[model samples]
Target: MSPRSCWIGSALAVVALAGCNNVSNEMVKMPPPAVTVAQPVEREIVHQLEFTGNTRATEAVDVRARVNGYLQKIDFEDGADVQAGDVLFVIEPAPFEAALDAAKAAQQKAEATLALANADLARTQPLVQRGASTEQELDVKKADVATAAADVASAKAALTQAELNLSYTQVKSPISGRVSRHMVDIGNLVQAEQTTLTRVEAFDPIHAYFAISESDVVELMAKSPGTSAASLKANPPTIYVGLTGEKGYPHEGKLDFAEAGIDPQSGTQMRRGIFPNADKLLVPGMFVRVRLPVGSPAPGLMVPDRAIGMDQSGEYVLVVNEKDTVERRSVKLGLRVNGMRVVNEGLEVGEWIVINGLQRARPGAPVKPERTTEIVEAKQLDASNDPAIANSGAQLSTTTPAKASATGGN
Candidate 1:
């Protein structure tokens, strides 16, 4: 081949190889990695402190016979609900009835004597006016009438006492509550206010008693003050409560009472929460958990818990910006609510956080952003539109509180 022709052919060959390499490079190039991102949502959150407590009854009464008598009948079932004034025990009324009859007889005798005195006084008044009877005799007649009148009054008082004793024979419950087992059985002699027949405890609108440390009280006083404020008795702070076997504080109550001062020995102020027990689930002496707000509810930024990452430094989350680059943000986390975590510091509302595909997302790497909110809205729509799924979801777990209120002591 001629020299010029050979050089031209080599150049053409090099150009062909470069074109192949260019095609290979074009085929190998990839689009940015797809990632799901969500903005930090604003929610109302209250900072809270948790304390352990136990349930208590608002009122308890011990039932006893008010009149001395032999117990004739037990009227209520042991460990059963009883209303106020319900008959709990029936003491024998025969003795009381006899006493009442004797009193009535005595009153009748007094009345007959009084009537006789009045007749005599009437006769003496005419005689004295006519000067036929002496004044001294008339004075003695008046004195006798007065004595008889006093006797009638005494008899009437005795009758009232006897009636009261008779009524006391029917033992009644003092308050509406559940009665305990009988302490005194039928056929036993029961003394008035001495022998206890049974005991009862009020159930609904139960109370939970807990204690807050002196430091906690001081902190609360400076912040919300609650019932610990200057007007302590009138305004009580709000509280959340949960019993054993509960997921969280499903019950809300108010701080009803606080000790006048902190206990010297324990350095804690005894506090009580009054909760409406409409379901009758809470009973006396039950152990409970309570959450008291340290501060008022305020708007805060929140994100899904899965988006949070932990390392040697602290908790952090990956945010995808408008430039499509991932950025690691160190976050000061507060409490967990629902399935989200509150970012107390270092995160701004509307910042796009990578919710899924965390493995593929790296700091400073570009990502193809997918709006997680859209996905959630779509899921919610599906839940509302599909009757079968809606029914099934209704059968799913009931709506639970998004946040956990209890915490370890500081």
Candidate 2:
């Protein structure tokens, strides 16, 4: 019985030892995990401050009736483009015409009186010298001439005023722009200097206004030494603008104006940009996206966003060395430009970064890194979802420069 038991135990121990040897051989023969790696892309990137703004016409005018009269005719259709001096409304010009004719007649009569006064003065002067007329009579004639001359001048001034009033009857646009609908319909009486006829707004070369925070302004000033609000206005920086539903900032402009001081209540400074609206794409009272580059373009390194990972130590990336060893690198990241994450520090250009199979990579362990030449195309930065910009709270909107009056007639 003892011999049988010992033999059975010996056979079991041998089987266990053989199983352990097989497991060890399998572990040693297993290959390293394959991972996709790419070198960090170097690009020229500019840090831009973004904001929401509103567009307004460069020149806006509220056209009004200068003379009191009934609106006889509307020469333009609603929302028509008009040039300066284009007749928009005829405000009972017939009455003004009659008044002008009467003034012309009065002016002619005054001129005749003036001519007669001069003839009389000439005749009296000769008579006074020849002693044909007494001194007192000559003086009386001179007084009569002076009085007639004054009356003629008064009549002439009246004539000029009448002509001006007549011209005012034909309401003309004072600026070249798109006109709003007429405020007063035909046969409606409009008061002089009080009636708002319509509005005209210049579209080409439009204005876009946005507000920037005082903190951001201070940062900008620090970046550019010796730069002040006045200097910014005098030598404007390039700006980009985009309307709602538009991709990127297609319109280019200049930061033409900046407020002298930041508003204490809002802690922001008003800034204005002027853009060419030759295509008529930009309209007043439209919400737009604006971008202003902070400093000159600088070189930066970027990697795919998926390649980055966060931990208790903050953001880190899996980098592969020349020996195919994986290393965990703590990196300082900036804004996301395009779709790539900007590596501000702790990463170098041309260093291989794990793009795929990150979970399979372990620090200080060997990996089969598959090198990839693919890179993200460096283009315009979309700051809409950038956490850096969102944290700064730079996206803000302000009131439009000019509001169209609802009561004005087009």
- Candidate 1 lDDT by residue in tens digits, 258-329: 878888999999988899987788989989988887766566666777889999999999987767788999
Q: Residues 78-110, candidate 2, lDDT per residue (tens digit)? A: 999999999999988888889889888887887
Regions of candidate 1 where Cα sits further than 4 Å from its true position? 1-44, 229-236, 299-410
RMSD of 2: 14.1
- Candidates in order, TM-scores: namely 0.66, 0.72
The positional error of residue 79 in candidate 2, measured at the CA in angstroms, is 2.0
For each predicted model, how many residue pairs clash, with residues at least 3 apart or on different chains?
A: 2, 7
- C-alpha positional error of residue 339 in candidate 2 after TM-score superposition, expressed in Å: 2.3
Candidate 2 local distance difference test against the native: 0.80
